[model samples]
Target chain A: MTHILDIKDLVTNFYTYEGVVKALNKVSFHVNHGSTFGLVGESGCGKSVTVRSIMQIVQSPGVIEGGEIHFSPDSDNGETGIDLLKQTERFMQDLRGNKISMIFQEPNAALNPIMTIGEQIAESYVFHRKNQIIEKILGLDRTGENLFPKVSANPLFLPLYHLALHRPDAFLLELIKKVPFLRNWDRAVLHTAIEKSVELLATLGIPNPDKIVHQYPHNLSGGMKQRVVIAIALASEPVLLIADEATSNLDVTVQAQILDLLKDLKKKNIISSILLITHDLGVVNETCDRVGVMYAGNLCEVGKVTDLFENPKHPYTKALLDSVPKIRQIGDLKSIAGNVPNLVNPPLGCRFHPRCGHAMAKCKEVFPEMTIVDDDHEVACYLYH
Target chain B: MVVVLFGVSVLMFSILMSFSPERRAVAYATSAKQIKEIPILVAKYGLDDPYHIQYIRWITQIFKGNFGYSTVASSPTLDAIIKYLPTTIELNLFSMPIIITLGIWLGTIAGIHRDTFIDHTTRIAAIVGWSLPTFLFALILLMIFYSQFQLFPPEVISDHIDDFISDNPDKFIQYTGMYVIDGLLNRNFEVVADALKHLVLPVVTQVTVVIAILVRVMRSSMLEEISKDYVITAKAKGVDINTIHQKHVKKNALLPAITISGWLVCLSIEGSVTVEFIFNRAGLGLLLVKAATQLDIPVVLAISLLLGLIYVVANLIIDVLYAVIDPRIRLN
Candidate 1:
C-alpha cells in the first residue's frame, strides 16, 4: 500500500558562521495513512528540520540540499506520489495548509498576535480556498439578504466576479481596490471566507467561536489558542497534519486534551495521517502507531511502535529507550555516552559509532545502511547489517 | 496631559530664569536705550523675584494668552510661533508621509529580500543618509540644484510671489500663514507652486537626515518579525511571502517603528533648525537656534514649552496607535 507521505534521502544543511552544519543527513522515512508517525529525538537532532524541509518552510542559512518528499494522499488504490520538492512555489503554496498542514509547538507563538482569530483562520481560506469560496459564493441565492444580490447590483460585479474566478491577482481587481469603500464588488468572496472560518472554528471545538472569531490571539487560554492554531491548520481539511512537537509547550492537562482532540479527529477520518514530532517517548508510546528514532541528523530506526519498543534493533535506539526515566522504578537512567556529535563535522562514518558499545573497525569507516531486523522493523547500524 | 505640560513649562521657565536678572532683562529690552535700563526692565518683569512667584506670574500671563516678547523675532512669542509654526508644519506635512512610507517600504523589501542586492542597496542608502551631515547634504543640493541648475531657490517663497502676496491682499489672501495652503485657499496656484518649489530642498534635507534612523529601526523590526513563529505559521498555512510580510509581519513590526517615528517627529522639530537656517525658511528650529545665539531666553522658554506640548501629543497619538495595532498593549 502506498504511504500517505514518504521522505527519501532528505539532506538539509545549515550554512552558519562556523561552517556548513549538516543538520539532516540523507534521512529517509515513510508515514502510512490513518496512523500517527512519531519522530522522537533530542533537541537539534533535525526532527523539526525534517518536517520544515518537507513543508518547504525552512528559514534561511538552512537549505534543502537534496530531497524528494513523495506525498500522495490516496493510499489505498496505488497512486504513485508526486515529489513535493520538485513542485513550483505556486503549487507548494496551494498544497500547504490545504493538503499538508502543520500544528506548531508553541501555540503562543503560532497564532499572529495582531490578527483576530477569525482573520487568522480566514487567512488559510483566503490564500488557498479562493476558488472553493468562489464556488460557494456562486451557489448563494441571487435574492433575499445574501451578499450576492447586492454584489450583482454593482456595475463592475460581472467583470470582478469573472476576474476573481480566473485569478485572485487580477490586475483589474488591484486597480479598483485602492478606494476601500469603492471595492464593494469583491466583498462577497471575503464574506464567504469569513463565514467558512467561523464554521471551521466551530468544527475544531473552539468555544463561542463567533465571539472568539473577533478576538485577538492573546485573549484565549493556552488550550484555546492551540485549538485556534489547529483550527487554522484544519481550515482547509488537510489530508496530512504534521504536528511538530505541538503539545510539548502546553501543560499536562492541556496536552492531554489536545492529544485527545487530535486522536478523535483522526478516528473520525477528519485527517488521513499525523506526522507527530516530539522528544517525549511516553507520548509516542501512548499515541503513535509507528515510531522513527533519530540521532545526530540521522534516522537510526523506524518500525511499528510495539516492535520498536519491545525489540529496538539499533544500539542508539536501545540506549535512547534505556535513558527514558520510568515511573517509580528507575534506579539510575542509563544515558548514551558522548555528546550528540557536532553536526558540522559529524563522525565520518556512522554518527553513533563513538557512542555505540558494539562499534567495530568497519563501523568507524562506513555509515551503515538500513537493514531489516524484524517484522516491520528497520535499523541503521553495522550490527543490524 | 495638562499636568505634564505645566511641569514642562515650569522646568523650562526655571532653566531660563537661572540666568542673571540683568541678562534676562535683555529679552525685555527693545532698543539700545532700553538695554541700558536693564535694572529697571528686570524690576518691571519681576525678574529678581523668588522662583515660584516668578513662575506663578508667568503662568498667569499665559492664562491671559500673553507668551511674553521675543527679542529675536522683534515680536511677541505667540506671534513669532504663529508666523513660523505653519511653515514648519507645511514642510513636515510634505516630507513626513514620504519619510515614513518610503522608509517602511524600503526596510520591508530589504528585510524580505535579506542579504540580496536589494537589501545591500537599501543598507548603503541608509548608511549614506545617516552619515551625511544635514547642512552638508543640504548645501550640496543647494550647490547643485540651486546654484548650478537654478532649479529650486532656497527661500520659503520666491521674491516676486512674496511681494505679490504682501502687496496684493485682494488678489492673494493669506488664509493660513502656510504659503502653500494659503496660496491654494486664495486660488493662487503660482504661489502654491513657488512655495512647493522652495520647499523641495528643505524637505529633502529633512528626509535624508531623519530617514536613516527610521529605516534602521524599521529594518530591524521587520527582521525580528520575520523570524517570529507566527510568520513561520503564516508561511506553513500557505500564505504567500508578500501577504505574510505585509499583513502579519508588518503590523507586528510597526510598534517599535511607531515609537521611533514619534521621536522622529520631535527630533525633526529640533532637527529642522539646520534645514530651515540653511534654506532661509523661518521655522521654530531656526528661530529658537537664532534666539539661543543671542541668549534670548523668552523665545527659548516659549519654544521649549511648545515643543514639550508637541512631544506629549505625538506620544499620546503613538500610544493610541500602538494599542490599536497590538491588542495585547491595549490594557497597558
Candidate 2:
C-alpha cells in the first residue's frame, strides 16, 4: 500500500529556562492511504506532540529540531512526495486545511467564539477555495439581477465582472485589485463564498443550516459544535484528516456518534485517510485498522489492530492491552508498573526499561531499533531482536 | 447608569459638604464689591442649615442649573465649564485617537515579536513613559520645543490670531468654541495652524503618558490571547499569519484593553491638567487647579460632578464595545 504520509526520525524539542525537553526523540511512523491509523499513548507521552510536529504547529517553546515529513497528497499517482519540513511556510499553508487538516481535542475551544458559524466555516473556503468559488459564481446566469447585483450594476465593476466571467485570469482583474475604489469587486466573491459555506454546513447534517450559519459557536451544543468544527476541516476537502483526540472530551453517546460520523466520512471517500490520536484503547480497537503504541516519545510497537491486540509484541503493548477489562468475566484491571518518564531527562536507553519486567542489562544501556517481525508489523524491543 | 451617576454625585456632594458652610458660602459673595457681606450671604442661602437641608438645597439647585458662581473665572460655575471644556475636549479629540491606535499597534507588534529587540525596546519605553512624572515630561518638552528650538510654542493660539478673532467677529465664527473648527468655518488657515501648533506640546505629553499604560495593558492581553487554542485552530486552518494576528489575536486582545482604554481616557483627562497648566492653555484642567487652590467650592463641585458624569458615560460605552467584540458577552 502506498503511504499517504511518511514521517521518519522526527525530533521535536521544547526549550525552557530549566532545560531543553526532548518531546519527540527520533519518532518514526506513517499512515497508509485509505486506512485509519491510530496512535495510542498515555497522557503527555508525545502523542499530541507527534501529530503537532507533522502539522508543523508545535506551540511556542516547542520546536521541530529535525526530521522529514514526506507527504504525497496524490499518493496513488506514482508521484514523488515533498518533504513537508522543507516546504516554505506559504506552501505549508496551502497544504494545511486543504490537503491536510486537523480536528483539535476540545470542540468548545476549537471554533472561534466571536465569529458566526457560517463565517468560521467560510474562512477556510475563502482562504483555499477562492478560485473554485469564483468559478461557481461565474457559472450563474447573469442575464438578470442576481443575489449580488449591486456590485455588477456599479459602473466601476461592470467591465471587471465581464472579464471575471469570460477570463478569470485576466491581467485586468489582477490590476483592478490595485485600484482602491474598484476593489469592491471582491465583495461579490466573498458573498459567493458564504453561499458555498451554507452548502458545506448542510452537508455536515446541521439542521436549518441557513439559520445555524448566522449563529455563534456558543449557541451550539457540544456535539453540534464538534460537527461545525468537522465541517470546517472538510470545507477544503482534505485528503488526510488528523483527528487529534477529537472525541475524547465528549460523552459516551457523542463519542460514538462522532466516531460513526468519521467512519461514514471515510466510507464516502470525503477523507482518504485519518490519523486518529487518542488515549482510549476502546476507541482505537473500535475504529483503527492499524495501530502504533507510543510510550514516552518512543514507538514501542506497530501492527494491524487485530494482530496487535491478539498477538501483542512489545512488553509495553502487551501490558497496555492487558489493562482493558473485558465485558463479562473480567479480572482486576491491570495497569503498567511505572509512570511515563520526564522527556527532558528520559532514561539512558529504552525509556520503558525501568518498568519492563523483561528488562535486561543491554536494555538499560542501549536503545532498541525498530525491526520488521512479520508482514507489515514492526517492533522496537531486545526480545524482538 | 442613572443610579451609578446619582451615586457618584452623592459621593462628590458629601465630600464638598465636609467643608464648613462658611467656606461654601464664599461662592455666594459673587463680586469683589460684595466681599464684606459673607455672613449675610451665608444667612440668605441657608449655608449654615442642617446637613440634610443643605444636601437637599444643593441637589435642587444643581437640578435647576444654578451651580453657584466661580470666583476663579468670575462667572457662573456652569459658564466656566462651558468656556473651558471645549479646550480640553479639542485636545482629547486629537490625542485620544492617536493614543489608542498607536498603543494597540505598538502593542500588537511587541506581542507578535515578543522577546525580540522590538518588544524589549517598546516595553522599556512604556516603563519610562509610565514612570516619568507627567509635569516633568511636559516641562522637558516645553524646554526642548518652546525654550530651545522655538519650533512650537504653548498657549491656545498666537496672540495675533487671538486678537484677529476677537477684533473681527464678522470674519471668524466660533461654531464649536474650538479654534480649529472655527478656523475651518471662517476659512482662516492661520488660526487653525496656530491652534494646532500650540497643541503639539500638550498633546504630545498627554499621549506619551497615557499610551504607556494602554500599551502595557494591550501587550499582555495580546500575549494571553495569542496562546489560546482558537489561535492554534486558525493556524491549523492555513489562515495567513497576518490574518490570524489581526482577526484572531488582536480582536480577542482588545477585550481586556477595552476597560484599560476607558481608564486611559480618564487618565488622559487628568493628565491634561498637568499638560494644560505647564503649557498655559486655558482648559478645564487648568481651571480645576485654580478652583481647587482658591477654595472655589462651586467651581470645584461642578468640575467633580462633570468628571463623574464622564466616567459613567465612558464605562457605558466600554460595556457596549465589550458586547460588540465578544459575542458571549451579548448572551448576558
DockQ of each: 0.86, 0.80
The share of true interface contacts that also appear in candidate 2 amounts to: 0.72
Please report the interface RMSD of model 2 to 1 decimal.
0.8
Compose the digit string of candidate 2's lDDT tens values, residues B1-332.
Answer: 77876787778778888888777777556688787788888888787888888778887899999998788999998999999999999999999999999999999899999999999999999989888998999999989988999989988998998888899888888889899988888888989999999889888888888898888888999899888888878888899899898888898898888898897787788778888998999999999999888888878888888888888889989998999889997954
Instruction: Tell me the lDDT of model 2 at B155.
Output: 89
Model 1 vs truth, CA RMSD: 2.7
- Give a tens-digit lDDT track for model 1, residues B1-332: 89999889988887787789898777667789988899888888788999899888888888899988787888998999888888888888888888889888888888888889998988898899989999999999999998999999996888888888789888877777899899888877888899999999998888988888888888899999899899889999999987888889888888898899998988887788888899988787889889898888768888888888889999999999988888998884
lDDT string for model 2 (A1-385, tens) is 8889999999999998879888888888889999999999889989999998888889999999998998988866676488999989999888888999999899999888888888888788778866555544555544453422221244555456567756877888788777897756767666666677777778777788888888998999999999988988888899999999999999899999999999999999999999999999999999999999999899999989998888999999999888877787477889998787888899988999999999999999999999999887999999989
**Candidate 2 TM-score, C-alpha based:** 0.94
Clashing pairs in 2: none
For each of the candidates, give the backbone clash count: 0, 0
TM-score of 1: 0.95
Off by over 4 Å in 2: A140-155, A158-185, B26-39
TM-score of chain B of each: 0.95, 0.95
